[model samples]
Structures are given as structure tokens and as C-alpha cells.
Target chain A: AQSVAQPEDQVNVAEGNPLTVKCTYSVSGNPYLFWYVQYPNRGLQFLLKYITGDNLVKGSYGFEAEFNKSQTSFHLKKPSALVSDSALYFCAVRDVRSGGYNKLIFGAGTRLAVHP
Target chain B: NAGVTQTPKFRILKIGQSMTLQCTQDMNHNYMYWYRQDPGMGLKLIYYSVGAGITDKGEVPNGYNVSRSTTEDFPLRLELAAPSQTSVYFCASSYPEGGVETQYFGPGTRLLVL
Candidate 1:
């Protein structure tokens, strides 16, 4: 079974300050991790993914995530937060060992509030 | 490309009523999926289709059914609507070519069961 966890229900940060949303995962084999952001009444938009190679992955809207294999974590980060960045963030994981048609397992999600 | 599209942006249903959520994608992806998002529970997969004429259940497939008769369309059916089925339903598609692929999502359909 592949599962992801976002420990924090909400994260608060002031505009221009760095922001981080923590995510951890459990997978049997190599993990394919991804981050998505959902605005109010909107579907989730892809942020970034960690398949292999670099530990750090850059994504849309100046968002990035670091994949810590040893720690089994993929935490989303931004150098400077913007009020517009306030939204719901989710972390998903897929087990590579699973054969075709493997569905992604998502975390409970974290609400990011960037105060202006 | 219109990407993934879902019809009936919002719907209200009474108990025992049935409805089908329509989803279509122009990306020509081989994999399509249906997921439900609750208030604070993130997303849970209800069903998926790897290709036309092939469908399978996901983590939470209790009250939902799906069919994929064409590559572009995959409709999810709710047999007996109940309060537990109220949530935001999302349709997504991806072209997984032997490796990991990104899933493109639709705006989502909000369903409220009374």
C-alpha cells in the first residue's frame, strides 16, 4: 500500500516570508511523489513531482519540493510567500512496484494561508 | 485542448436518487480516473479506466460505478444517492507511457446529497 501524510491541517505565513508544508509517505518500492494545489472551488493543479534523479524538484508558480529519501518525506516549499498562494495543498504518492493502472494515494491536505 | 471536462458543475440529490457524472477529455490519454474530495479529507479514488472498455475500482468504490465506452468519455454513476456521497468529484486523465505521468484534472463537479 502507498500512502501520503500531511501532518499539519493548516500552515500560516506572512507575505514575503518562506513557507513550507510538510509531507511524508509510505511505499513499498521507489516512490513517485507529487504535489498539487487547489484553489477555492477549483480542481487540483499540478505542482511538482519526484520520480527520480534530483532530490529537489521545481514546479509551477515558484513552488518547489525536496524529496528526502532517507526521511521518507517530500515537503513543498517556496522562497517567498504571496497572499495569492493561499490555497489547499496535497501530497500524493504512487508505488512503482505496483503494476499498470496504479492509482495515486493522497494525503489529507494542508491549507496554506499567506497573510498580506 | 480543453483538457479534461466534466458536466453538471453542481447538483443536489435526494436520497435514493441516481445520477451520472459525465467526463470527457481531449488529451487522448489512455488512463482516466474519478476521485472524490471531501471537506478536509483530500481526494479518494472511486474508479478508473485504463482504456476504452476497461474499468476498475479504486480505494473507495462503494456507491459509484463507471463505464468507458470511448477513449474520450468516462461517466461515473451513482446508483443510490446518499448523504455519504456528497463531495466534490474530479475527473482526470493521464498518458502513462511505461513511466510515471502527470494527471490532468477537470474543474470538478460538486454533488450534495440530502
Candidate 2:
């Protein structure tokens, strides 16, 4: 079974400070990891994905994530946080070995709050 | 391109009542999915289709049914509404090419079961 875990329920960061939202995954074979952000009353928007590439992957809205294989983690990062960056972040994973439709399994989600 | 769109932005259903959540995509993607988001829990896959006339159950498919009769539409039907069924539903579409798929999501449908 492929699954992802977001250890933090909520993360608070000051404006202009670096923000990090932790995420870890468990999957068989290679893992396809993805990060999505959802605002109030809106569907999730794709941020970035790690599909057999460099360790560090950059995404939309000045966000990036580091895919650490040894740590089994893919943590979302932003150098400068903005008040408008407050939203719900989700981490999803799909195990390439576990074929058949290739559905994604998402984490419980982490709420990020960037204080001004 | 509309990408993905779900109808009935908000709906209230009573116990034992039933309703169908409509979803349509203009991307002509071969893959479509339905997910439900709870308060604290993230999105849970309810159903998915690889192409027209082919549908499969996802992680959580109880009390819910889905059909993919056309490439552009995938509708989810709830047989009997319950309080536990109250959640936000999202429809997404994607084209799986070379083993990498990027799903495009709809605005979502907020369903409240009383």
C-alpha cells in the first residue's frame, strides 16, 4: 500500500521567513510524489511533483520540495512566506510497482499559516 | 478550456434521499476520478475511470456509485444519503502518459446530508 504522512497538522511562519511543511511517504518500488494546495472553498491545485528527477523540485507560487530518498520524505519549502500563502497543503504518493489504474493516495493534510 | 467542472456547488440531502453529482471535463483526458474531502482528513478516492465504459472502485466506494459513459463525463450517484456522507466532493481528470499523470481538479461540490 502506498501512503503519505504529514506530521504537522498546522505550521505557522512569519512573513518573509522560510516555511517548511513536512511530508513523508511509504511505497514499494519508485515513488511518484506530488504536492497540492487548496484555498478556502476551492479545489486542490497542483504545486509540483517528483518523478524520477533531481532531488530538489520547484513548483508553482514560489514553492519547492526536496525529495529525500533516505529519509523517505518530501517536504514543501518556500524561502519567503506571504500572508496569502495560508492554505491547506497535501502530499500524495503513488507506487509504480503497485500497478492497476495508478491511483494516488493522499495524506491527512497540513494547514499552513503565514503570519504577517 | 473548462478543464474540469462539477455541478451543484452546494447541496443538502435528507436521510435516505439520493442525488447525483455531475462532473465533466474538456481536456479529453483518459483518466477521471472522484474524491471526497472530510474536515481533517484529506481527499479520499471514491471512484475512478480509465476511459469510457470502464469504472472501478477506489479506496472508499461504499454507498456511492459512479459511471463513465462518455469520455467527458463521470457522474457519481449516492444511493442513500447519511450524515456521514456530508463532505466536499471533487472531480479531477488527467492524461496518463509515460507513467506520469498530472490531475486537473474541479472547483468541488459541497454536499451536506441532514
Candidate 3:
């Protein structure tokens, strides 16, 4: 079964410090990875995706993720964290076997807290 | 465009009651989906529709039903709601445009069953 795993339940970092949220996935064939962030009482917002090329992918709100195929990881990163960046982050992988539009299998989310 | 919208920002229901969560996307997306999110756990796909009249079961489709009668509307129905069904329900739509098929989501609906 295709799945994604977020090893950390919560990650804390000081404002203006670099932050990393770890994610690892297991899937057959090529992996299509995605990152989504959810704020309190709100729906998820797409951050970025790793389809084929470019190990490092940039996304919305000054976020970027590096796709490490050998490590089976796609960790989200930011150069400088902000208090507003604190939220729940999820990592997902697409199940390619599904017909038409593939469905996503998500990991247990990780909460990121950026302290001011 | 309003992207995707879900009605009833918050709702509380007694066990055994039923309700329909309305979701509409003005983006003319060909695909729509319904998911339930619980604390700590990531979202679970309840149902999805590829197009009008084309519906399919997803990872977690046991207690939910959906119908896609039009390209813009895909409503999720819960029959005989239970306490376990209490969750934040999110509706999302996506257009398979080019290589990037990004799913745009709505501000979720919080459902609580007593």
C-alpha cells in the first residue's frame, strides 16, 4: 500500500531560524509527493509537489521541499521561520494505480510551532 | 473565481440524524472530492467524482455517499450520523491542467455528532 509518514509529531523553532519538517513515503513505481498546510479552523492549502524532475521544489509562502529519492523523503524547509508559519503540515503520496485522477494517501500530520 | 466553497461552516447533530454537506466549485473542475480530518491524523478520502455521473469510492467511504450531477457541484451525504463521524469535512476540486493537477480546497465544515 502507498503511504507517507511524518516522523515528528511537532517541531519547534524560533522566529527567523531555519526549520525542517520531515516526511518519508513508500510507494510503488515513481512517487508523486505533495505537501499541505492547515491553519487552525481552516482547510488545507497546497504547498508544493514533487512529480519528476528537480529534487528541490519551491512552493507558496516562502516554502520549499527537497525530494530525496534515495532516502524516500520529501522534507519541507524554510530559510527563516515566522510565528504565522505555525500550523499543521501533512505529507501525501499519490496512488497511481487508481483510475483517472489518482487519490492521495496522507501521513499523520506534524505540528510546526514557530515561537517569536 | 470563488475556487471551492463548502456550506455550513459548523454543524452539530444528534446521533442517527442525517444531513448533506454542499460543495460547489466555480472553477469548472472536472474532479471533486470529499474528505474527513481528525486530530493528529491526516485527511481521509471519503468519496470522489471524476465528472458528472462518475463517482467512485475512496479510502474511507463506509458511512458517506456522494453524487456529481453537474460539473460544479459535488455534495456529500451522511446517512445515520454517528459520534465517530464527527470531523472537519473538507471539499476539494481540481482541474487536470497540464502536468500539475493541484487540488484546491474549501474552508472546511466542522461537524459534531452527539
Candidate 4:
């Protein structure tokens, strides 16, 4: 079974500081990892994904994630935190055998609190 | 392209009452999914369709039924609603082609069962 684990329930960060939301996955074959952000009373927004190739992937809002195959992790990171960036983050993974549109298995999510 | 659109942004239902959450996507995406989000839980796929006339159960499909009669519409039906069914429901769509794996989500429907 493909699953994603988000270790932190909430992450506190100060403005202008770097932020990291940890995520790990378990998959049968090559992993397709993705990050999504959701604001209060709103739908989820796509952030970034790691399919293959590069270890470091950049996404919207100057956010990036490092995909570590050995550790089976894809942790989202941002150099500078913005108050508007505070939201709930979800980590998802899909197995290769999922065939089409592998139903994304999401983590419990990590709430980000950016204080100015 | 309107991406994905869902109706009834918010609704309050009485226990045992039934309702349908409408979802439509204009992207011609072959895959559509229905997921529920709780207070702490991120998102759980309730049901999904690979294409028209084909549907499958996800991690949580109980109390929910979905039909994909057309490529553009995927409606989720909630029968015999209960308090446990209260949550935010999301409709998502994605293309089967490579690089289109990213699912575009709708604004979501917040349901409260009493």
C-alpha cells in the first residue's frame, strides 16, 4: 500500500526565516510525491511534485522540496517565510502500479504558522 | 477553463437526510476524484472514476456513492447522512497524459450533518 507520513502536526516559523515541512512515503515502485496547501475554508492548491530525475524540485511561491530516494522522503522547504504562506500542508504519494490517476494517499497534514 | 467546479459551497443537513454534491470539470480530464477532509485528517479519497461509466472505491467510500455518466460531471451522493459524514468535500480532476498528473481541485463543499 502506498502511504505518506507527515511527522509534524504543526510547524512554527518566523517571518524571513526558512521553513521545512517534513514528509516521507512508502511505495512499491518509483514514487510520485506531491505537496498541496490548503487555506481555511478553501480548496487545496498544488505546490510541488517529485516524479523523477532531479533531487531538488522548485515550485510555486519560491518553495522547493528535496526528494531523497534512499530515505524515501520529500520534504518541502522555503528559504523565506511569508505570513500569507501559513496554511495546512499535505504530502501525497502514488505507486506506479496505480495505473491511471493513482488515487492520491495524503498524510494527516501539517499546519504552518508564520509569525511576523 | 473553469478547472473544476462544485456546487453548494456550504450546507447543513439533518440526520438521515440525503443530498448530492455536484461536481463538473471542463478540462476533459479522464480521471475524477471525490475526497473528504476532516478537522485533522488531510484528505481521504471517498470515490473515484477513471472514465465515464467506471467508478471505484477509495480509502473511504462508505456513505458515499458516485456516478460518472459523462466525462465532465462526477456527482457524489450521500444517502442517510449522519454526523460522522460531516466534513469538507472536494472534487478533483486530472488528465491521464504525462505531466498532467497534478489534480486540479474545486473550491470544495462544506457539509455539516446534525
- lDDT to native, each model: 0.92, 0.92, 0.92, 0.91
Query: What tens digits encode model 3's per-residue C-alpha lDDT throughout A11-113?
Result: 9999999999999999999998899999988888999988988899999999999999899999999999999999999999988786579588889999999
Q: Where's the lowest-lDDT run of ten residues in candidate 1 chain A? A: A94-103
What TM-score do all the candidates reach, one by one?
A: 0.96, 0.96, 0.97, 0.95
TM-score of 1: 0.96
Tell me the deviation in Å of residue B65 in model 3.
1.3
Better of 3 and 4 by lDDT: 3
Per-residue lDDT of A60 in model 2: 99
In candidate 2 the C-alpha lDDT for residue A37 amounts to 97
True contacts kept of 4: 0.76
Query: For model 3, how does the per-residue alpha-carbon lDDT over B1-114 read when each residue is reduced to its tens digit?
Result: 888999999999999999999999999889899999988898899999989999999889998999999999999999999999999999999876447577889999999999
With candidate 2 superimposed using the best TM-score fit, by how many Å does residue A65's alpha carbon deviate from the native? 0.5
Task: Name the better of 3 and 4 by DockQ.
Answer: 3
* Residue-wise C-alpha lDDT for candidate 4, range A39-61, written one tens digit per residue: 88788998988887899999999
Of the true interface contacts, each candidate retains a share of 0.76, 0.74, 0.74, 0.76
lDDT of 2 by residue, B6-104 (tens): 999999999999999999999999899999999999799999999999998888999999999899999999999999999999999987654688888
Question: Per-residue lDDT tens digits of candidate 1, residues B20-51?
Answer: 99999999999999999988897888998999
Interface root-mean-square deviation of model 3 in angstroms is 1.2
Every candidate's DockQ is 0.79, 0.80, 0.77, 0.75
